[model samples]
Target chain A: MAHPQPPESDPQSPSAPTAPAKSPRVGLFVTCLVDMFRPSIGFATLKLLEDAGCTVVVPAAQTCCGQPAFNSGDNKDTRAIATQVIEAFEGLDYVVAPSGSCAGMIREHYPELFADDPAMAQRAQHVAKRTYELTSFLVDVLGVTKVDAAMAGTVTYHDSCSGLRELEVKVQPRRLLAGVSGLSLTELPGAEVCCGFGGTFCVKYPEISDKMVTNKAEEIVATGADTLLAGDLGCLLNMAGKLKRLGAETKVRHVAEVLAGMTDTPAIGDPAASLPNKER
Target chain B: MQSTSRNFKDNAHKALNDATLQRALLNVKSGFQENRARTVAGLPEFERLRDAGRDIKNHVLANLDFYLERFEENVTANGGHVHWCRTPAEAREKILEICKRREAKTVTKGKSMVAEEIGLNDYLEENGVEPIETDLGEYIIQLRHEPPSHIIAPAIHVTREQIAVDFRREHSDLDPNRRLEEPRDFTDEARAKLRDKYFAADVGITGANFLIAETGSTVIVTNEGNGDMTQLLGKAHVVIASLEKIVPTLEDASTILRLLARSATGQEMSVYTSFSTGPRRSEDRDGPEEFHVVLLDNGRSAMLGTEFQDMLRCIRCAACMNHCPVYEAVGGHAYGWVYPGPMGSVLTPSLIGVEEAGHLPNASTFCGRCESVCPMRIPLPKMMRHYRQREFEKGLSPQKARAGLSVWSYVATRPKLYRLATRLASGLLGRLGKVKGRLTTLPLAGGWTSVRDMPAPEGKTFHDLYRDRQAAKGGRE
Candidate 1:
């Protein structure tokens, strides 16, 4: 599969020879789902970036990436959301994201979204050029081939559609997973296919989404892997939701959380996890 | 083919519950998907050929009027007639007129999507001309009184048991009790049954895959040889095709043909690739005497120079449908018309207005698999999004969805309100779901939780966590 290495199509491939004189300043685009559902992924991503010598900051003004609006053909809303995002991260040297869906929207769709407005388009193009998915940034820009992380089971990876197709993050996550100690990576059949968590699509067409995830669960179970890992939490939660419903005990976590060796917390969709304190 | 396209949700619901249809769809899911991947992997030049194919179709489209005229001139010179029709009604009437002129009581047909596009079979049957389907897949669906589910495999939704029953009911003259469990058995029976219809029919009706302007030849590729027999045996041969089927030369046709079967069925070449120019010469013994072509425009001309012109490049390979998870789940009948899958989603609304077929485009997950496997590299998901945009702009989408999106857009633009709203919602939902790690159900989210549980959020947002961490590392040198 020629994975676990930067593809030749990387936007930053020309000058990968030497490390920078200063730690690169980064603005983490905490995607809406990660901000709401699983904050551990954000911490794991920040730790990995910091470990790789990045000066990371989370922009306070950041919100959604406008993917839901853009995908549903609400271009007006999409432009507004995109403008807010572009403004929030414009001062940084890099904007990295943990979810492929959000990262891909910035990297691939932002320029197109702002194409008519010349100044906004220029800023968008710059933001897109500087944007990278978390794993791809660590391996491609930071040149970190290995990580100090450990896991106990045979884990299979699901390549979320947006990341694999739009950002070409197929090999980056695989590369990081290979460095985890005591972890055997078994390739899941049809791993590159979607898990039917296409944001609004799952709820819009539940039957079709259910059928797609059901097939995905069957393939996951067939691999006999005890744990499932993927970069995007949307796909992980969708697959995890189905896996738990089907009564399979397979643990599901973001590739970042596992690769950061922070698996002490319960799996993202595990029903057995204890609730947070009410009087914080 | 009546358009129940508007009732797609209902159609899909029925299709999902039909066990027979589900079993029949398995062949399309496994056989076509696996074979196409293997064949595409073997050809390194597949992507290049897709570019070539797209360029050829684009060139023809740019000069479509010129190519059609040149093709007509060539056809006339070759002792053939070309009937240019702007609508399906005109094409059907012209075809019937020619058949009645030849006193054709029976018409043998090769598989043609344009034929389906015009609803030719029902029109002919209503006017007292018998149309006998010659393609194996088309023949099976024809006997069952159904429109084709899949374009290439017309009877993709019909099971072996259903076909056996259909044959036993229709072909009373044949042996009543022969074992019809095997696919080969069904194929043998169809071949034997359709064999006589070819010779007995007075007119042959077939669709052209490509029409060459240089030679005035109409080409059709099929795994079955019935097309050749249909054209040769009948007294008059009628080729019905859309206007976009015209190409400049034979070389362009062959270049596109290289991508055709490999994408359609993963075969290096179809069993038969027949090119007919006019009719047989005076010296020929076994060819039809009259040759005519019906060129139907329908709505293709409207698509040119629009956001949809790229769709003219489609060669009806069905690769997009074969690999689509949505199509695999509910099958082609759910799409509710002549076309299905990613290609159908884009092309249907373009042909039959988006107001009627809005759901087709929205049905996709935008998985990008269709574009990945497409032989012509059609940006299917992008076009589907275009349809959604049009539907939204026209206010054709459901009122509830529009209202929800409006509210979301309003809140999302105001970052403060968006933060406050999400924080409160997440805090309440988090506390509720923290005990269980997931939510079995939630208000207005039953569409999601009806099928699977929704994962609970962590107590704090990433922004909140990041702020806390930064405070702890305050004033770091």
Candidate 2:
């Protein structure tokens, strides 16, 4: 498979209005963790894309991408999950997810997940090529840095592990945030480190998970940002929980919700009341 | 030989307190990681090569005995002796016998991890042989009476300032007033000291990177060319290599070498790639008169057909160690074994027994950086989990941790009970927060609460929230 010219450099970003537009249909793959807990991330994803001049569609048939079961050595459940996901977004113009962990499941892992079946491997490869994380698609494919959506607040971005390592989703979100008027992007130290939210890993090894997220929260607080922004809701929720428990004055917001200017309500928490406590 | 792991806690205490060593380790740690990343990023097909490399290693490991015998035949046909040892005792005996037969007083050696495994240097010294480590990094550790902190860069825990002091004490003949500030100065001083040992030593010892079965060639990759000098000029040459070092063909060796150097020093290839087929070939201009290959099984063959067979595929690129966050925080010496980092976490337990190195596997956050950057693509974090599983199965886990896990397992298996327990736990913890939403103490989770306030759960568990949301959305629409 050829490496896609990143959406930022593609002819699509600047001249997307004049260029012949391909099918605008996008199948939003609401990842299992997000679907079960943070449904607002799904709606924010829809609003962000539709606002960016794309015809967004949520394939309700989508279920978990089967990464959890697959990585845990349960091939039976993984295949069951993969079969459900493949059927959900089969023949779509593009399959997009708000989570890099899930997109990596579809893009990098799905083919390996079905190596025993040649037909499924081919189908997985196709899906892997078209699938993009929301920010990668927004800045790279849609070529829109600013969503014409604006919010006045200091926000620090957490680079999710899968998104940063697997999909290189660091700069695209940063680029889009830089273009947003009145949005101050505060850089968090050791931003590339994992937030200890490895799906089931949080519950499986909660002690270590708590240590990692607590470290991440301390870094987020050090930035003195009012809100913590990240591409993946899994990390945001984990960070948010820690932030809330510490009574940290900072709110946790998804990059999509910020880019879409939908930060008025508490999707995760209230942004205005966020203040760093000395106890932290 | 010696169980350094038994002295781990004391060694770790010393390692933790030695500010000078810590300073040196911090400087060298990220340098290697950065170089490796830059090198791998240059090769577009590096990841594909990694997969292929892993497959090749898997294939070789599955047919190890056949490959070992084939390698032995090839080495013997090319005028080299092949001695196989099933245990460390046999390996030590064979090497000592060879050294005694040569009547060697001094032995110059290249960097060999396997030698360290067998405790060859200490054994040689005890048997009236003075072993001189020719590798600059190895030589530094020898002077300090310390084992290597890193596999490739021995004495990586020592900085240049410490090296200057070591050189001044070890080589008192050198100009005392001479200022040595640059890396080049240290390299040159070590080289000048070791060059005489290379020529005067009766025996030369080095490690084999790969034993080519088809060519009977023992390949060694090094930056300093010290291994070549040790083997080429010495009267008797001994290659102390592990059983897993054999490859079926030179092509396979090249494939592994391509990834090895790139993964290691981030070079497309190391400065020197030497292939020695046999006793320097009779007609060769410069070579050893007698060549011996001491193949040590040392519990490696037991790994065959086991869950750890993939571990044998490790080319010792040190990528896993370089990328590991835990390894960065507590340097390799803290691991309390010959190998360190993610690979060491899995390997030391298997080779040295889990009871000895059980804490090594637990010393991880399961961050998965090691797996991502691994050139051989070893699923290191998952493998660590397998060791953790073994600890639990063998009842080796601490009673407190075991009880904690038992309770967790019970809760994890029952969703309704789990939710009820979590709800009550979070609610109680939430209400106990003092001083504007912070809990300074907790009974059960004091390990967490001691360091940072345990995050209160967001009122409802995901399961509870989902149930309510589904009901509100008209029974899932």
Candidate 3:
């Protein structure tokens, strides 16, 4: 596949500091959760990519990453969705998503799903090799240690299960967050455990899901972090919704919003409650 | 055991509402979980040992026919009898036949899950033979007429407060006002009562942790030493085990032993590790006079070359259940069968037909923690997924769930249709939920809203916004 003529890029924000040059062109796979529930994370991802000196595009043909089907044991559909995604992003130098779950599906499970189809399996393998979660791509591929972004108050980060276990994304986000001025990170107990927002899992087993999220809520509040940030919107929504129902005042937001210095939007599930976070 | 696994949802619901059980579950964190972490960290070779353990089991499973035949020959050479049973009924019949030949009126048990699996206790009692449970946890549960909630910790769901009441009622021979408030007090009374049962029991039955083909020995590892007493004092000793427990050599058993205690209870080693080859020799004193080994296949040999073959490598460590968040919440009874937790999720379907046990495999978040902690490195989540796939393909899953998946799949495979459908659905739900920034109720989403609110979407779809942003750049991909 040949690359399309590259789009001319503009500096995203004048106040932000970035090293400018011709860089790799990336296609952002705005995951199903991000595309539906929260588009702010998608924009935040764009700003981070642009600020990091990469030309990014959004492929319109993409829909779900087929996680809901893959998880439900529908391999035939999983293969179809994966094959479509491979063709959709086949021309890009890198395919990045802000979700570890979606990124993990594409990176880890897609090739296995298409193993019987030799030609399509090779395509899935190629797409998987270049796919990455947002923060991991920035730190790993772009050599980004610090961001020209900052947020106030203490915030605890959650290691979403797929991100931590399959992709090994525990340290990259932390390493980047360490550079954000005025941000103090507290460790969450059982941070590696699932928040029980396993796509269809929360609905299928609500009592079990409630118990898991309640435990997570108590631990998040116990840290007294005042705010919670995670890489995946599915987990953030689950934790944030539970925290709200429990009458806890702890706020929740996607990690990209804080990392891109785009903290003006309201925290998730906070009912238009604005982030008091400002430039440090 | 008969399965109530079909009512898994309701059982989990009740288990969650039981406050006493909830309080007891808190101990799991400070109990097995912490101890296992500490012991594992102390041993740098734990990972290497796990590899060795997995390899030894894999080798035995590949050559299972050879090892079982060799094991039978060796046991016979050591003056023991081996019975090959194909089903649970056959196994129970064999044990009863031996008991009748010995004129056994009472049998002592030492915490065998296989006995529970075969419903051995109730079957024996129905045949006019009394079965006495000597393990403290098993004894507590036996008196309550409850099945073992967990494989290793039989009474994990029962609180000590509940046990105090049970002891006062069951042990009517004891002082009514005795200090039975502590765990040790309960243990002391149980020890006194069971010490009498040991000498009276004509047959003693215990489960095998490993069956060594080379040494003709059946091994059992226990912390309480009840297994030793059960085997030593009875006139006849019977070892009941599944077919997969056999290993080719004693050294292979030793390697797995190094991993078993630590993974199960976080101990450097269990207190009593006994190996019994056969009946007592002519010169030997204080040992059982008759020795018998019952090897029950019961659907296990059929799993030899299947996707579930890895499950046979499990040593019943209980580490998978200890770290599983779902098991941590509802306890083992909710799983509704002999085994529970991640290992049970895979094995239950294989042993007890998938139709009754399909719900067990579906009750997971696929967190991968169980596979991470398994001593044999069994791919538990993958196997559970395999069960789910079988259920789906066989049309055994619910009609609504299958139809929903098909409808969703039909759209998801068609990119243009999927994008348009999502765009319209989000546009409508986003407007309805925008005011409060979350939805308290949703169509077909009662499971989510019954406990917590659903975070609503921002009004516009991401593609609309992204296309506009890229259009302003005079480019579209």
Candidate 4:
């Protein structure tokens, strides 16, 4: 029942201490999805963190955040993976991930995974206290009000379920997106609803998953936005795939890519038929 | 009643394909979800009220034996007979015995999920006693000989056109060309048909929303006044409820009532909140001559100390289902049980064996929306996961899925091996998808590729790329 306390040097406080002599060391958790499907998100996260005056480290020992195992009722393996992640990201000021889904798995569910073991539970809590979703780390912890980023397009943002519900990452992403020049944000209808890419759930119940993502795709296309952005790769992939299957032209990318002004790469699910086009 | 829960996948497939059901399911979002959101926003204390409601249920559950005993004593003292039935069969037989004692030919019922849980109507028909459903939604589904789909809105899956067709087919004595285009028109017709049945019935059965342990009063909240007429007009009144329905006091019942209406139908209060104490008094003008309360255990007692005990706090509001995307997509019937949606996913597996209803728990995205909107703060997804854990432990999960998970875990546990495997897989997939940037087909991923393409990886793992970046920077700083 103990509440996790915020770090001592509260950046948002009016009387907050000035920048410390040493830069805050950040351990970037390159989520498995971002690591495999789109390493650009990982690079974008690195740029965002480094630009915010922090020293960033990519911990190679970390792979998945143990979410796939945790959600599948395989707690034994989840524990093993979580232990590896904890050991890998030890001694960092913050463990930031480009994904709310993976960050939430570490921040929220890790402690719960080790509830029965007090020793490991303490370690999990320590790691959890330092873990944060990327946008939240930028806006909330770093007091980032604006970003030196620009992207041209009317864009809509889908609030991934874990980020919005689990970590309260609704406004932090939007707070940063509002600062991006030349970007008009059209709010997605039912933005807080899940995109149905529930890790393995999409395949387990593909029919149901299709219906949900199909509805999401319709709403995204209805916005007439040229691009779609979300914080988590899982949801972006799901929506992007469905949008492609339906032959819709709305591009998809991780929110970090747009926030870091890193949209030079082709949008997710877009064919590599055309050369990379920089929006700015 | 009869569980097709074992065939949940097939049921969900059928539900997904049924266009009419799909269209009707849309109303759940605009109707219940939006209304509840607006209503809860208007009331600032709704969250605190939820907390209060949860604490009260937790307290009552902790002393469930004491409260239930007190409830029975109060009911007996109020000139009411309390029947303690351990199983659904016992509860059904007890009600049938009371009906036979009165020599009842027909009985009218108000909306009671417990009745549906016990399959009262089918049992009554087999015993030569006709059970007439008086609630509009209940009556419609009953006429079709179909079980209720959504709990609060029993016939929610049925469109107006379907209901009109059903009415014409069943009520052959009525005019075949009656206009039932409007909701009021359907309700008016149903009212007229059910009016006489209320007075003609020898026994009336109603589900108690809350059984006050303090006063022995059985409370029911209904938009329609049929519950009042059914209980008062019959010669004998029987209240069928589960043991968990007992609350410590009337005040506690009122606190839960504040949440039930807003959560269930977005009303500040139900139009009719009736509380019946025992039967008729000696000086009472018009009421049932005899009163009986049947408390069925039906696996609820076993749940008291288990992980699913929070399920007992459910007030049958259906808020969880209203906000659930999975439930929204497939509708209620696909859950293939008496109770459906998120609550049903947890409760069904517990009430029925988990072996029979394993699919119910597994068929969720775990979006956490159900738990977010739940009035009782039930950790529905957590409980569902617990059911999954049980299935895994019991080897009830599919062998293929288990094998796949094992292979995934085996590699995932070894960071070096995981890196190598993901690097190779991403490299192959990225190469295959070089042209389109996505793969339309892949081996062992037919479920995914059947409806949508799989976006290819960026050809290299982040670990590999980051390591190279570090090497270019001349080692770790």
Candidate 5:
């Protein structure tokens, strides 16, 4: 596991010529949903970060970020799972996640989880400060606008509710994708609109959920894009499920997967067969 | 006289029958949402702007009384008058008195929702004063004698064809043989007619987007330029609005304006961003002779300390309604109130008691999309839940729903009983599932079955499957 370090420039020194330190160690907090259900995203994050010349590590003990429980008002279960997560990744130069919902849980609510304990709150803040969405981590911290990853397809991005609103993860991803050699970033009509996958909301109220996802699917098809890209796996899965059910051929892939040169490996199950034709 | 409430089934039935309204709604299905996203994408610091917008509203709301006093003083200092009204009747009376004093006969209004809340047009009409709606959307709804379906786009439920018919019937002076061919044609005709009213009217009534305390200016943003022309050409200009519209400084106003335009219409700025500081400066030749600001309280001052204080952060963007599935299904009129959509679901019940609007809260699937897109970042779903709880506590929900909820609550308190009940129900449902894979309708669950099919439950519940699987795997059983 990697631990995020303080910037090398001295806080005490008023005037000093400072050299930007070597790319700090960054551990990919591949969310539990992506790790268990969508392993390609994890591999993509690793490839993208490593390609950028940074030390990368994947902490094995990282589980669910307790978002499912927290959103359900089960504070106790959320705290229990969150504690396990913090303990597992106690030292990391930067704990980064590809999903906006997981990143928000780590950054926004982790402090509340440890509100009773001051030391735990401080530790949670440390993790929160270092944790960044995949695109934000790459663009803001690493200052890398372009990556070697290339693919050919028209893609529109879905702004996951947590990422777009909670963490403001809109531009960083677009900037990175814009720099990619051949990919075209088309705007989905109502792209900032929620896909209506409110975690438990999809199950509890499936009727209304059906209407929302169907609307989203219609909008995605309207964009005339062959692929859908988003930072959060939850939104992608919801959209993908709807698209598949509707028999639409639009494929869903995490933004990290597209940027990591993993397009050659088919995203769903076959890594070798998934690569773009040019890469293969 | 509480005609505001409608039975949930009745509202849905009414909306379903309105084919013309559905056509109109389809035209604007994702209109605002697309525009807002496009506008936000253009600004690099959009999120920072949103945060600042939220903070500014929060600050003004916290010190509302002080700001109101300061605004009142500034308006008075600028040769303008400020009238404080605690109720709708007071607001109506104040406006009437001002009209009576000025001996104003014909008045032109520039699309004010606050005016609708006070029944201002009706009051003026009873007193023999004519009020004309200037905005194209508002004009159609006015001619048709209907309340605004959507707040900003008042006559959103009326189709272009319907408007053409309305204009033909009302504008008898037009050629009876000529056909209304296009929207541009209808708009040009309306523009020609409304231009006359803009100049001929003695007073112009408009709503303020924000009341700036620093310079005592009332800011109005309009795309059609009606608000600008109304204030600039009329003899007297009146702003009958809420106290929550007051902001402390122009900088804060600009920050809000940045978010408001993008959030509402996806415009970098409205076509006419008119700031009327006490009607017009003395040197200004073409401006109203008298200016009046009516700070309306009605039920807002009481909401300041309540759970709904966050609602005051709303800039009337209607982004929530645009993305809401329920709003898409039933349209705005089904809410049976001035405001509609997620914001309306929470607000309608608050303003008109729980008994009158018990169904509004349940109208949502609790999708939480409204909260996500809200520039102010209000927790809309939770506030809606508060309304739902209030309705349930007051015994406003239907008897069957209440009974069903009680049964579930009883089962929830006892885990063993819950498992038994679920197991028995699922087994019966599984047997029924063999006949057809789903139930098209269910007795006593008319609301759920009306819109969709209920999938047949599996023979075993999650608890039962979890226990059996764990035992097979040599884990906890």
Candidate 6:
């Protein structure tokens, strides 16, 4: 593994104008779901960043993005958790999350949460400007259009609500996926609609959530795709769980796992040996 | 109307199980949304028009008192009566008084959500007056003795087959074996039946799309010509509008009108965009002898300066409900009020107490399709969240939900405890589901597991793995 040069040695730094420009330093906000349920996504994100000639660090103090509290209308606790996140991820060149929902929270909502405290509000605004979803960082900020990875499967992508509406992460992932070899993309009907995994909403109103996810599952299965892919883990989990319950043979995985060519792990919610590695 | 919003969960469950309503709801997903999308695509400046509409409403709201007074002055100058009402009971009483004065045995009515808000028809019927719905959809629902299911399409929950059955049940005077298979057949039969009611009606009641302060004119846009007949053929014409419907001028009204029909029914313009300033003049041909405007406050004045003030900008286009996935799934009646869907989720709690309608705001998935499609650019989800905050502050949210949230927040804010708890839980669950990589049932998560399986965690926390990976890499170069 390659290590990034110290900040003082970077040519872009005012202190050392003669030295070569160092790689961009990125702090990975491995969301809580990814940290526990699927560490493979975090590793995949790290590999993608490293392969793009960037230095990636997983900030140890980061836990969750505080969305679960914020969406539940517990703004007081949300502010405290956001304060901790700001303190941990400060001073990095950029903050990137493999999940758009978390990145959207940091980028779109953190500043709104600190509207009363002007000093904290300013710090939050700074951090918010530097935060980007992984695919967005790769395509929009890093300007990398292609990846050195491939997989053989027909997959449909589900655009999660927060990422699609709040952060506008529609074409970034699709643009990168166009570069992968042997992976055909099928369009899912009503792909932009929510799969009803609204943090606490699924459990709070399970019947409504079940109806919405069932509609989404029928649409996904109608496309006849062998695999399902999305950026956010919450939607992926909700969709995968429903697909499994319906006894569909469709495989589910995070887009990063496929983009980074890490298909050795089993597909989400499937039996351990259900899928064999077929990367070409 | 008596609100059953407190029973939103039960209503939603019943609606989900209702087979006919489920089939009728398919029309909303396929018809209005696709039509609006196509119509909006033809107009490149639809978004800019939305901004204009929002700004116009905001300006009027900022100077609401001024425009309202100006409107009242103009109405009085035009030989019209303006009655200010602060409550539904007052508005209903005022309309009843007008009917009593005119000795109106029957009144023909256009589709008015404000009328529904005040429960005017039932109140009139109880007071020995008959209120006949002139709009085709409203007429069908009236025959069935049901409230309007949708704001624009009042009978969207009723299918043509059901309507035919209703007609056969109610219209025993008609031929018992007549064909009623097509929509045109229903329309022709309804038109013939309502023609007599329009002539017999002593008073007309209709809702205003806009109350123009400049011209003292009340506007009603309808695809059917029934609204024109309802106000024209009757002896008196009455317009029932809420306070927020007052716009500054006709130009402002026209600008908002550009977005209304396209948002509501996806038409460039409705078939009849009729405006009535006052009663008929001495030399006039066909017009009402009296004109009255009942301006109802009905808990709207309190929303003018608060976080919910943006909700007052709604034009009632039904776009929010048309695009809402929740409304699409459960249909409109599940909301259990005159207003339904995303707008109802915010406004129901404001009009009715949040305690009575707490489930309305909590039921959404925050998909944001409503806010995206709203012609007036209302931040509906944000307003819904504000209602949630109110519920949270008042301790009106479910006790179990609040307790779970507090416990989770307590653990989440402390990273060390969170990591330890997650590690132990994931390791245990990982072992329990080592074969399938998913759990068929979870102990405490029955809400999730009852409907769908829960995927097991991948054995260890990323923090634990990363720390070990760093130690193996010689302690982070």
Once fitted onto the true fold, the runs of candidate 4 whose alpha carbons sit more than 4 angstroms away are A1-20, A276-280
Question: Against the true structure, candidate 1 has what lDDT?
Answer: 0.87
lDDT of 2 at A1: 11
Please report, as a residue range, the 10-residue window in candidate 4 chain A with the lowest summed lDDT.
A10-19
lDDT of 3 by residue, A124-207 (tens): 998998899998888877777688887888999899988888788999989888888889999888888888888888988999
- Can you write out model 4's per-residue Cα lDDT over A1-280, one digit (the tens) per residue? 0121234452332221333444577889998888889999999999888788777877778888988778778889999999999999876778999988899899999999999999999999988998899999887887788888998789999999888888999999888888899999999999988889988999999999999999999999999999999999989989999999999988999999999898888889876665445333
Per-candidate TM-scores read: 0.95, 0.77, 0.95, 0.97, 0.70, 0.97
Could you tally the backbone clashes for each prediction? Answer: 0, 5, 0, 0, 16, 0
Instruction: Give the best candidate by DockQ.
Output: 4
Model 3, B19-65: lDDT tens digits are 99999888777799999999999999999999999999999999999
Better of 3 and 6 by TM-score: 6
RMSD of each: 3.6, 7.1, 4.3, 3.4, 8.7, 2.7
Judged by DockQ cut-offs, the docking class of candidate 1 is medium
- Per-residue C-alpha lDDT of model 2 across residues B82-155, encoded as one tens digit per residue: 99898877988999899899999999998899898888999999999999998888998999998887888887
Q: Report lDDT (Cα) of residue A134, candidate 3.
A: 93
Backbone clash pairs for candidate 6 read none
Query: Which consecutive 10 residues in model 4 chain B have the weakest lDDT in total?
Result: B169-178
> Candidate 2, what DockQ?
0.11
- In candidate 2, stretches whose alpha carbon ends up further than 4 angstroms from where it belongs are A1-149, A153-156, A162-181, A184-190, A195-228, A231-280, B1-18, B434-437, B458-477
Better of 2 and 5 by DockQ: 2
Report the C-alpha lDDT of model 5 over B281-374, residue by residue, as the tens digit: 7688778899999888877877888988988888887878876777876678878878888988877777777688876776664556788678
lDDT of model 2, residue A190: 73
- For A142-212, candidate 1 gives per-residue lDDT tens digits of 77888989887899999999889888889998988898989999999989888888888898888889989
- Residue B176 CA error for candidate 2 (Å)? 3.0
Runs of candidate 1 with Cα error greater than 4 angstroms are: A1-20, A271-280, B475-477
lDDT of 6 at B376: 93
